[model samples]
Target chain A: MNTTSKTCLLLEDYLDGQLSKPDKDSFTAHLAECDACREQVRVSEKVRELFNQHPQTGLSDDADLRVRMALRREQYGKEPAKDVMNLEETAAWLGVTPGALAERLDEIPAFEIGGRIRFSRKRLEKWIEMKDGDILLQLQQSHLRKDNNLLQFPGGKHGKQQSGNSGAV
Target chain B: MTFSDEELMVMFAAGTMAAFDMLYERYRHRLFRFARSCLISVSAAEDAVQDVFMRVIRSATQYRPGYSFKSWVFQIAANCIRDIGRVERKMICRNSHNDTSGLEIDDRSFHVRRIVAANELDQYLKVLEPDERMLLILREYEGLKTETLADITGTSPGNIRVRLHRIRQKLAAGRSAVDREGEI
Candidate 1:
């Protein structure tokens, strides 16, 4: 083929903006002179316009949440969240007796599948997160009451404390 | 600090759900657009995108930081769409032979009118094989580089460029042309 025909064949890459700078410049120079190639470029640009106008459908507002949930389910299902635990397992995870846990079942987040109470490790985690702060606060206050030093001694009375926890502290 | 897709992917492998979430947020819409364009049916396209993410997390541990994560997930989506297309094609074959009425959901004509009646390219896309259609979508619409398209499609860049040229020629032949003497 002649040079013009060869350049005409580069129309796809030219319109795609894939050509290197010099090649693009040459193609641009060629487009100015070549009628067939310019017309082809116009049609290709129209094709591009069609692509631009394709109207991407159904990426609804919840698509992220939807796919996210789907991925979560897949990940959880594959990894086995081991998150949902039976009453006995949940009690074991919580370091409580099953009987003790049953007393607090109403307070804990749980669901009954087939009449068997199960707890989500996720919900349990959040529950622990909420209550652990209070538990920690209570423990800190109890320690503070014993020491009476947290306020009195801005610097902790580390040496004055002769408790068994002296080494731990 | 903002992380690259590859960085986020590596972080995701290290068990950061936020990294995965970031990856999801970046890709969900783009993947949906590609899937919707090629798969035609909205539900199938959505399922394909969901399937892509599922595969992403499932294989996130295997993702290397050296590769482009965009290419990685798109390859997964492309494979997912191809798999769905294969099953649908078989059903279409059976449905065609049996003249089945109930399975028309997968019918190209029905879906063309329902979902893509207005997109002029969709008609031309109908004539393309799935791979060619995907290649065109990735290259032209998605603005993926020839090398990235190569990586996603598992072909050489030269092969991609050649295919793109041929596909464009086919599309131009199929589309109404600009007049030789007049402006577009």
Candidate 2:
């Protein structure tokens, strides 16, 4: 079968019984004739099962609190007095639309709990600085590049000067 | 009930300690796991996590709102682990090839099974490079998305996916070999 067909068959939809009737039929037909596809299905299923069996490891309660306390003291230079702004609130504080902020969610590191995104305040703050630093770095690089180009050609005025000097000499 | 991650970060920058605590509570375990997986030592992992938080604390004042806090923290953790691993390898060059053995297996349901399985898998993992092992663990154990995995590892998602596929194939082949020997 074609790459597209193979991809469709390999997708979660095909495995999860979410595929449309015709698509499912096509995938099964292909699987019936293809030993490789059949093996892939088995492997995928095993992988899923193994992952499910692998329990999620978590931090100790005290360690969790310690980490937070450390971060608080480190970032703000003081003990935490209250909960900070959340994802939505941060987006609002940045003066951008929520969609715009959400678009860059991947750029921000986060953990999802029941569909809600949780962020590290310390990390987020650093990220914001790094982003601004990146912008500044880019602007500097662009300006440097422009200056280098000008130095290389000195362009119209320099060209005119060189020609005039050559003529006078 | 509590402020969200973004809110905490904003509050953190604005000088609230509570927000910092919330963020720490959220990610400390994952970061510790990521660190321990790489360094293979509890002490080293703890140190790495501490360093990561320190960096975050020092850098919080520079935070921008739109960026992903998860990606940023993972990136820092990855870097911290990488640096620590490098130092560790250099300090104990003779022990560089030692296998990873300290992964805490506490699931009582499959205590024996997990022990045996982890032993078998640990051997195979030892054969791979540190970066490769990290890639596999992040993808398999952490269940991070390809994009987020890429962001953490500093590779393109396409590259991460291809690497993961190759690693999975290798692991499967190894398992098959073990099965043939009736070891697992």
Candidate 3:
């Protein structure tokens, strides 16, 4: 079959009973004359059945708790404060000097409980990933792309930049 | 009355923690399963899903009304997985190659072996590229409509359909290869 026919055959709407009645009728007629497309549809249906047969593995309770706790931290700017750790211990777990951590303490996500500060391992890991070098590079590249796009499309709603004072000669 | 996913997202954007919780509860399992199926690593999947939720939290204010919340969420997840791939450069986790123990098939009968071979679903899927894996899982496992899959992956529906078809052929071939290996 041609590429267009192959792509058309992959449309799940006909096999899935999702197409409009008229569209479905046309598709059914088309399928009746096409053995290769029929086999393609059959295999796709089998793939769906195979997927349905497997049980969905869920997050463990601990993982769920960690996610919830992390959300709570994001929501409140700090968690309700459980398993509070001292600054040194937190730094130790993070493999950083307490002094270095202190310098960037505000950058780290932390919680204050009982007039003492602490950190959750989950939050710390997130904080680390947020500061991760790879993530930083990705963000940098994204910003660079956005900047390039902006530069390319100068003078949309943002008004054109006056290059060399536009007739200043 | 329980709110719909979109309603919950509106509430979540308004800083309603309960709405966020409800949304998480509703999608966590399916999202985790999709991520796990795509990444084939339990920890990586969990991290990817967590990052997806975090991005949703961060981008709540930018959400528009026209899009389906389900599609939006899965799009965030697809983007997250892609970003993970770009950063890590290694799509599958190291352990994915090592977890072949459970994939062994019996030499019983060809029919039985075919059934057992089919059961090694993950192994079969591993042959496809990351995008292909995402397309297959989203369509077959998550039962997402073609339009929504297109929206999530930012591809034309026709292209997504073609990719899904290609993935199906690849998976079938992978399974057949496994069956041949078993025969030997």
Candidate 4:
């Protein structure tokens, strides 16, 4: 069916209603003789219908209201003075489950206000710095371990020099 | 008479809240649907739509004339969702595999079952490259024109058509990416 033909390429445009009248006419004529193109267009139409028919389940009615309220806050409320965050937002920001965050309560500087766990942004920034320090330390330790491993290898620097001198000979 | 999207954007930039409202009405549902395709949860998609509109409101003055407002907002949406994907580690949080708890012995139920196969929808999206899937969603569901798509992706309209053609070919072939790779 010459799926790679120029006419077949136009089939996408035809299905998308992007073709001009004359081009559409010619493509329709060509479709009469092309089962592959016909089937391709049919499947694509079905796919388009499938996508248009539903919306990945459905959005709640408050979805729009929430967005509008957020936009209003952005437009009118100015920036939020977010010095503190609740448990869920903090856990989400830390990229961990709330239960996991709870496990690390001693490690983190968290407090409770109105009997709910809260995290200070400043303390979290300090925590991030500590995490970065630990990561850098681990990386340095790994590099040192690699160097020591190289030193203990049978063909280390001394053997390499000897091999180089022999290769020169 | 309806104002053009560009005009409405310019008006909003000039501090016309009504114009911003007009733009919101135009895009709220459409953008949510687009975000829903790439995100894991309905709430996440709703959050993404909010993020997109907030960015638009905050940066309205930066929108210049001759720039397609549709493309500009969609570009922001793409970036916003991609960042969220990174933060969330992009999990596939499906309710269940083959969950048909609400079916009935009727034509309407039959159609609902056929149409609302979320797993099948996931497979359809999973086979394509992420960028290809984004382009398809923007084209078909968001109903962006080829020109605006080209503007969003910074390519020529002809190139956009070619890309969409290739994507269509992939869909019609119904071959998994692994199968296509094995061909090579």
Candidate 5:
């Protein structure tokens, strides 16, 4: 009996002992008659054995300690803020509605303390570092300026006009 | 009798140093071997296993019950190996020059054959990507179930099964390709 490509892939799983008993029996029955699949299974088993025989390699003592220390520091670094500001206060600060501020919570990392969710002051400060606006609009403006510069003709002598119009910042 | 992995982890979480030590002993060799296969560097593998143990120590307090400790530890080791692979991508390049010819094997003929087999297998394993190698290590070496693999990898069990199937196919192809090249 001829086997499809999917069935052949299934045969690989069967040989790996990953198939259920019924599937295994079916696969074995098929393997009993199928020369190509049997060969594939043979090759797969040898590969598994070869992989098992390979020895393990390890990292250095110092570096291992460093990574562990780093992870621990990350986990225990910041104490959850106790006096979390209410949604109204946060929305007022951002100049957005409480619903809009709530939507942005997914973008900003926060932790819960005493059933009240709170954002780290440091994290909020970092968020403030970025210029605010639709990101695509900023990207489009930058792209247009770059194109206008590259497309400028030699000795067009429109320097004052270009600078006056382009110097929006 | 030895405690199960779950029991050991629970004990470790409760700050039992002995339980942590026993868990380390139980899985140290296996974890070392798993990392070594993924990173293909002895020092890197050692470092990865140590990092995993340290993470285990620090996160013992955060360990949730009803999860497989083996999968958790193996995932940590896998992540460490990935970081090493990213940093040392050039250093860990596979070549016959840096192959297992350095292992000192002065024993009987059978022992020598086993060592050679091991060496060949290591060279073959260097072909797989780090993620593929980790999956193979978890399933083949650690004997983890699909559910455990899913939890560790953060993928659905069905996806893990499919990925495992593909990984086995890739390894099988790698082995056969080496055999065809007369490298076996």
Candidate 6:
């Protein structure tokens, strides 16, 4: 490679102080001769300096503590804080096959500790409650759909009953 | 005696809380800052940092000592930040004046100018795509070696070198523009 083109390749390493003695020597020699390269080196150095100069940003003290606590909770699993059921126990309690429950382990709110997955009774109950809510919503939507269908077919028994009630009124 | 990060990772893999704590103490600040730079919000950064450590905890047994712990940990953090960015879809810049007051100064740059320039730097960073921003932050701010960056980014070191050159050029242009404005 030509000396100038080669020197350009060394700029990154030179700026990072990663160049070896021989390479550094040659790079500096070229820098002394080439003002453009010299200016580029100066600007690159200044740029790195500017970035390095900015203040060290870190999480706040409380944030650090919170993160540590959260990690500890994750590693230990949430079972220790309350009554918990192991995978088999939870599976039996839910009346599902162990293999089937294992398939839905992610869908269930469970924690893994010591390579064993455990389910928190409280959280599982809450999750079940949420699931029940979802079921209720689906039932309501299905009922609404049925009612709309019956309303559309006014000759149906339900629609005739409604029409008779309206005529009597 | 202080354990190497990889050694700590091994101990942590064996469920040693002390080792995990040591790792946390060593990396909490740097990782938080790394996340903050990427997510651009203190709260989001906080969440991302916590998620990163949680991932480490979850995957402790799966970590192989063959790799650099630093790169592995940062790769996890970068993934966490990207996940949060995708889910949140809102990148918030720190209120430079309010948030910058407590950072430990590394150089004697004029404080006001540094703040303004740093804010401008954030804006430019936000303009780039998330992956580019992560690449720049990891290389420039975190001072990760090119090899380590390549390891974390899953790219060749040669590719990292080329990309870093372009990133530095952008940073240099932004710095010059901000400096000129300060003079004006």
lDDT of every model, 2 decimals: 0.65, 0.59, 0.64, 0.66, 0.59, 0.67
Interface RMSD of each: 11.4, 15.9, 12.2, 19.9, 19.6, 18.4
Q: What C-alpha lDDT, on a 0 to 100 scale, does residue B48 get in candidate 3? A: 80
What tens-digit string does per-residue lDDT give for candidate 1 at A1-169?
1234787767767766779999999999988888667756665576567776654544554444345445544544555446677653454355443344555567788997765667899988897798875643433233212222221111123312322221221
Q: Could you list the CA RMSD of all candidates, in the order they appear?
A: 14.8, 21.0, 15.8, 20.6, 20.9, 18.9
Report the CAPRI category for model 3. incorrect
Which candidate's TM-score is highest? Answer: 1
- By lDDT, the better pick of 2 and 5 is 5
For model 2, the superposed segments whose C-alpha errors exceed 4 Å read A1-57, A60-73, A76-169, B90-114, B180-184
Which residues of candidate 5, in runs, are more than 4 Å off? A1-24, A33-40, A52-169, B97-115, B172-184
Better model by TM-score, 1 or 6? 1
Per-candidate TM equals 0.64, 0.56, 0.62, 0.62, 0.57, 0.63
**Candidate 4, residues A70-142: lDDT per residue as tens digits?**
5655664453535776543454354333334555577778987666667897888887797875633443233
Off by over 4 Å in 3: A1-10, A20-29, A78-169, B85-119, B172-184
lDDT of 1 by residue, B69-161 (tens): 988998999999999877766655532222323222455766555444344465556557888888877877887887888898888977876
lDDT of predicted model 4: 0.66
- lDDT per residue for candidate 4 within B16-42, as digits (tens), equals 666787787777777877887776556
| Candidate 6 residue runs with Cα over 4 Å from true position | A1-4, A32-43, A78-169, B87-117, B123-127, B172-184
lDDT of 3 at B174: 80
DockQ of each: 0.17, 0.09, 0.15, 0.12, 0.09, 0.17
Q: lDDT tens string, model 6, A63-110?
A: 654564456446545334347766434543553333445555667789
Worst-scoring 10-residue span by lDDT in model 5 chain A: A149-158
**Candidate number that wins on lDDT, 1 or 2:** 1
Q: What is candidate 5's TM-score for chain B alone?
A: 0.79
Question: Least accurate stretch of 10 residues (summed lDDT) in model 2 chain A?
Answer: A146-155
Docking class of 1: incorrect
Which candidate do you rate higher for lDDT, 2 or 6? 6
